[model samples]
Target: MEDGTPSLLDDKKRTSKIARLSLLSLFNRFGFALNSIALPLFALAIGQDEAFYGVMVAAAGYVQAIALFPAGTLSDRKGRGAAILFGGIVNGACLFYLPFVTDSLMIIIVYALTGVGSGFTRTSLDSLIADHTKKGNERTKSYGITIAVATLAASTGPFLAGFIIDPVAFPLAADPLFRYAILFYIMGSFRLAAGIFGFFTERWLHDNPDITPAIVEEAEEEPDDSQELNGNSRDDLITAILFGTSQAMMGISSGMVVPFLIPWIYAAFNPDPIILGSVPAVANLTLASGTLFVGLQSERVGKIKMIFLLYLLTPLLTIGMVYIPIFLVMVGFYVIRMAVANMARPASNSLFMGEISSERRARSLALTRVMWTFPRQTGTLLTSYLLSIGIMGGIVNFGRFFFPIAFMLYPVCVIPMYLAVRRNKRIVEQRRQQRELTDSVEVP
Candidate 1:
């Protein structure tokens, strides 16, 4: 494990590093989840229609996506710690101001600005993990731990927000609308904590002479064609783009479901906050569980195959959501959908990381994030606007129209996931053959 290659297994000291990284992952994800859960409700509080809210949220995605590649390049050059810290502070500061802004345009602007921060943090965070851990099982475990922590934070954030943001809880409160702002503030605080934590734990290339350009140049100059296919290829890039696009499209399709689900469920039966929280809670738990499972198996299953299986399951799980009527049944479907979606996360991440050179990992991941976020934001903007127009005033009817669209588009997303896996497999096989040939010649 000490030989040049990275190891996923952690010694006692490395375990500490994983812990710190996991904490950072948790805090960062907490900030993201806090906004994701509250943003729509915040817009609703301000009398903004669905479309307006969608546009606001989607704008963030577009900005984040657009900024990702640049942010990655910067991270690769400047160091992950500094990048994350800067983004965190900026993101936190923006969150603190979110409560004060009332105008829709101003809110959109703020969201977009936050996107820049998001791009900075998100692009570098995973790469930081990759840098710390040696490639193989250790890498997989580290990523899995990160995902589990993030999912745990994401699962908890919304449930907590649901209680905090409930208007009834704030009957005598100074400004009920400000409750969402408070949540944002908490999220910001978490981001700040993550930034500080990251500052201490991240290993900067500038500080480590071993990882300097001299090493990179040597690695690049080595005429090892066998390892050529080990990294990202043009085909892998295309597949990544395709997969990213599909994920974004799915985001658009699924965007309406969350906003409408509560209302629809309430209309079908009596409104129960417990049920609302429970449904999503179950889903998130499933996702977290699946992430944990995948993380553990990341090496054994291989990253590419795991992603392919996960993508294939998405349409089936999501379509199941449309048919389930009972709240519990709906929760069941949600669980399946979430687990399947999340199971692919580690694999997808590994594939992205595996495909690119270490220097470009941040950029590649950022690009993937951009693709996923942009489409979802576009969808959110479109759907929210339509909902504001009362296109389908009823929740059930809206689900009927939207869920199917999401289901149909899911297969398209799978195409990229499949292609990436297949391309990776081809590359791996090619490399194996070349290695055998070289071994034979050397033996002679």
Candidate 2:
């Protein structure tokens, strides 16, 4: 009620709905993993270089950046379910077209279109999840369970895709390109299924009388407009901005490194397909574990504190991951760093979303994503350009240039969020003391 949504599902309804959404998201993530594992390799197979791959990824980000705000507004106005349904279909279709296209321009265009679908699905899904849960630990728990389940599938997808596509392993098709195409088709199928299931799931939730709009009216006889009219709206906006900026900084750091990891491995080590695939598989599995574990700890430790700690740890890990000469040791650092860096997300998201009104939640989330994606994409482009020109020496030097910058930025980014949390706590304490004084006066 405090978050400003029209309805809140009871515990029973909330549990059931969250379960359904998690399953749907699980399917989507699995499909996404398959493509993600294959796409860069597929590009490399097609004789394109790192710069081209960066351009390809950036194109999608660019389109996604453009679509995010409008998609958020659309979800706010129309319905979260509709946005999910539409996004699923559009995204699946775009992905389906990928294996067939050999032309570089067409590939970029189609891949870019997938961003539109992603924009709609991601914004709507987050909003829908937030809408269902109350602020604080409950929301964090929901996100943790959902991400854990979804990422469980994601962890497996890479291994499976690699097995099927690996010329040394299964080698279903004589042509490597054919193997990739087959993987793409399978990926598209799962994505399409996720969208269709999401639509039905939304319908099922709506049919629950307890979750209906009519029941929401009965639950709250009169709405309080004061929450919005008070200065809290200004504070909420400011908090949202700070949160977005922090994420953007994180994004810029990650964009340079995360997306390029597999590509970097391929270029530097020229490892086997299964080896290449295992990197992400191991990372995702750890990520799922880390996300769930950190989420559970977030409430106990305090959301802000948990976030700051994680932020501080990642920079140190990044440096180690960058410098360690041993391949497996470096990967160990990479995996741990990936887990450590991302562990704060559930806590971070819950804290920010808890403070924002439901009416403004989607837009605020979208704006935050835009801030993250734009800079992130720019970092990607910068890295690619540097790689293309041989400016950073080579791929090995990428970590040296980007990771240190990221290391510096990570600690700085947390400052704004820390300030916001302090301000919020202070205001809440003031309000509580004022209420106690008012009660004492009334009693006298």
- Cα-based TM-score, every candidate: 0.82, 0.88
Worst 10 residues of 2 by lDDT: 212-221
The candidate that achieves the highest TM-score relative to the unseen native structure: 2
Model 1 clash tally, residue pairs: 11
106-156, model 1: which lDDT tens digit per residue? 988987788888888887888887766544555666688788877876787
Clash totals for all candidate models: 11, 0
RMSD of 1: 5.8
lDDT of 2 by residue, 212-311 (tens): 2111112333223212213356777787788888878877887887777777767667778888788778988999988988767788898877887887
CA shift at 135, candidate 2, in angstroms? Answer: 1.1
Q: Give candidate 1's whole-model lDDT.
A: 0.68
Deviation in Å, model 2, residue 342 alpha carbon: 1.3
Regions more than 4 Å wrong, model 2 = 1-15, 209-233, 427-444
Q: Cα deviation of 183 in candidate 2 (Å)?
A: 2.4
Off by over 4 Å in 1: 1-10, 167-174, 204-275, 424-444
